[model samples]
Target: MNERLNRLANLPLRENLQGLAPYGAPQIDVPIQLNVNENTHPLPAEVHRAIVEEVSAAAVGLNRYPDREFTELRERLAAYLGHGLAAENVWAANGSNEVLQQILQAFGGPGRSVMGFPPTYSMYPLLASGTDTTYIPGVRSADYGLSAHDAAEQVKAAAPNIVLLCSPNNPTGTALGLDVVEAVYEAGRASNTVVIVDEAYAEFAHTGTPSALSLLPGRERLIVSRTMSKAFALAGARIGYLAAAPEISDAIRLVRLPYHLSAVTQATGNAALKHIDTLLANVEAIKVQRDRIVSELTRLGFTPASSDSNFVFFGGVKNTKAIWEGLLEAGVIIRDVGIPGHLRVTAGTEAETTAFLVRLEELLTQGVNNSPS
Candidate 1:
């Protein structure tokens, strides 16, 4: 056997994969896919035209490798982020996932610890482990809000090298208020630790929820990552970006792969950026849909989180799995969060939301009838 293979062959694979599951969204071919929080709108014609034109123009460059720096996209992203810095403060990757991985590589590793609050995005712990960093959790308060005092205590006690936070956090649609984020940043800065805010759903946040980017001017240790996936309707284009101080961005750039983003992806992302107005309009519509779903779910007797993201999370229903299964059987699919009796449903188009509610009503009625009197 090869020496490296022989050295690894004796090790248990499960040990490396502890506390992680295979990562993927569901693949059901349901007509109404409310499972993943993808933007339900298709790309508008103008955006589509621009993407096609840009990609076609770049097609001749297939003979050469893409620009390793992705300079133009960086400039465009910097402008989009609206901080005073230029491309020096921006880094692009295959997706926000890669952006996150680079952040972890730059700041987290063996013997160092990374911290996060749970019932947030599921990826933080996995990313920490992939970078060989110790993963620590500071579970949120029972109300799904971050306890800044507890977080500060944890940071002081653990002294982790990196702290990951998600605003308008995933799976729950709850946001870390700016005050809490600033408190976390201060704690991390005092420890010489890096703080990363994952703002994948920032566009959908309720008005006045300050973006961590708004707080980045004087902070050297803070990084805020954003994606064109959710609100931009470009999940398939795979463009994720980071906004940070120049030094940190440079460190992230060093660890990322050369040509980390393809020429086509850069072209597509730029085109999408040009249509930000239209995209935000779609986000507005989705917000309306989200509110309707929340109110309807409440009236249906399920308790939902006061979500500020593009989805709603509700619980307190009996037979959660049965309701989920029933929805699937009815050709509507929503996410089954592992939290007992809780499930998440993404805001879809008006038609899709109507279908989901209709199916949910059926499930509720059936559940009541099947219950033991």
Candidate 2:
């Protein structure tokens, strides 16, 4: 912890939060950063120019507060989704994290319980704690696959107010089939539990993989959250939104702060929508690198899970921290996701991917951890 932050902890604070550390991955300044799941591609110039012009127009209204409803932004997002969803079913926020926090605020506050499969997103528990919701950890397979049966069984057991399902779950890139979503949603209905399907990496999923948004027609308690931070290459712009039934969107509005979406944010997101095609052009390239990494890593004797997202999670790591350190020292960085023998790395450009595999191979050949016994 930073010395200054440590001293500030001495001040008055909530008891539950007294000893809790903030959540974040290492933000190291590495030459090739494959840690954070950010789109390594540069922004498309067409989209960049559009954003500049639109934001400049928004700047003219700097004196006025942003639209409280952020109506236009919602409509733009709905159009992008194009599953017969309308603005009434969409809600926008600064980031997917905030969108989740708002959901917890509305449906998961004190006395309510929230449940999620383990080793998913690290933020679920933190969001629960921040909102005074009790966090229940559910079980997944050793490889992090959650079966529909187990999902329903756990939901029935916990009887939580909110159930979070992470498709193409973080730390491991496994996506849930629609059967799993249907099972879990059906299971939750008995307790009136709100089921949240987080699809932050959905854009990177293989074609024909269904989104939870498609299952939203009659499921009122289901909310599917997404972000522009990943495949859209707009992490710096900080736009995330969710799609649900109109009533669920209404519930989020009750908890969101007034004028939460700034005019600039609305404008930037709208402009990005105009060029969604160009912005998402790198997704296929990323998928190529992702698949390449999986094949090459398997050939090198490491066990990598089948990935539908932009990153790969591999085990057979004898020492995760050791491997991570070796990569960092070689000017490449990957995530040590706290799984004993596992690490995750985002798919970057072709050159970056080759650089990572070459350096990792060098480390392995040198017998950093793996050795021919």
Candidate 3:
């Protein structure tokens, strides 16, 4: 591996790309896999049939390029979002990552910067780098929390061209109050900044967790991105979209590849949207397990954070590495998010959740060292 890396380093890669690692989570196979925050439930059989039928129809037209506009998908997405959004106010890409990359391409590049709070989504900095945009790591509170005032103040200080906010944030699995989005957007106006709220996990958020989508009515520069990969159980389909002003879609068009979203992708997304209720039923079930994980973890004496998303991020480990390895040995796998004393786990089916909890309890009983590693 070292030799291969050395050979690649000699190639004429872009300066910004030097020595950067690719972004992804560990893909280890395990009995109960909950590392990536995927919806563990299988797609409803009805939705599965609909997707196959839609894809089958789309296959007949493979000879031609997909609708470059993917117009119908946009319309359906808008209807699903339902905040007075129209097709003109929507755009989509393979996943929210690509949607965000396009945002950086349109509004950020060398000499421009994008700011994001640390211990948030790991991808934001990597995306900024990939787009040749300067990545400014903004500070979060000591406990990985961000308040509206502190967030606004950070934006004012950085004055970046783009700001990426992840609600019900990754790794931490907690939702941010809309006041943070509102405050940050106001602060960014002075710089004409493009503010993006990544609500990739929004569907799993606990009740009354307000979305930044509600703040979209007047904020043209603000964008709220969502994905079918999570609650919709379409991770393999890779359909992610955003809601913003009509002009924002037009701006992304300037930088987007021709026919970026394929006909099949559009079809699959539309089919799933048709069964939105059915797919979302799994979200409630997953949330049940998520709450259980939180409650049970606290009872086990691990300090689990309050999570609105379908995952738990917890601390109070004496040996983080030991607990992680012990869980792996027990045939369950979760994420060790590189935080000093905290780890994250996605809520799976009741059985999967039970397996994880039972194994975790056993590991604690067996006295796997908790001394921080």
Instruction: Give the Cα lDDT of each candidate.
Output: 0.84, 0.91, 0.92
Instruction: Name the better of 2 and 3 by TM-score.
Output: 3
Instruction: For candidate 1, write residues 191-219 as lDDT tens digits.
Output: 79898899999999887878889888888
The best candidate by TM-score is 3
Clash count of each predicted structure: 1, 0, 5
**Candidate 3 lDDT score at position 124:** 91
Per-residue lDDT of model 2, residues 195-270, tens digit only = 9999999999999999998899988999999999998999998999999999987888788888999999999999
| Per-candidate alpha-carbon RMSD to the true structure | 3.6, 1.7, 0.9
Candidate 1: minimum summed lDDT over ten consecutive residues — where?
364-373
Question: C-alpha displacement of 1 in model 1, angstroms?
Answer: 26
Q: Which stretches of model 2 miss by more than 4 angstroms?
A: 1-9, 371-373
Q: Rank the candidates by lDDT, best first.
A: 3, 2, 1
After superposition, candidate 3 runs with Cα above 4 Å error = none
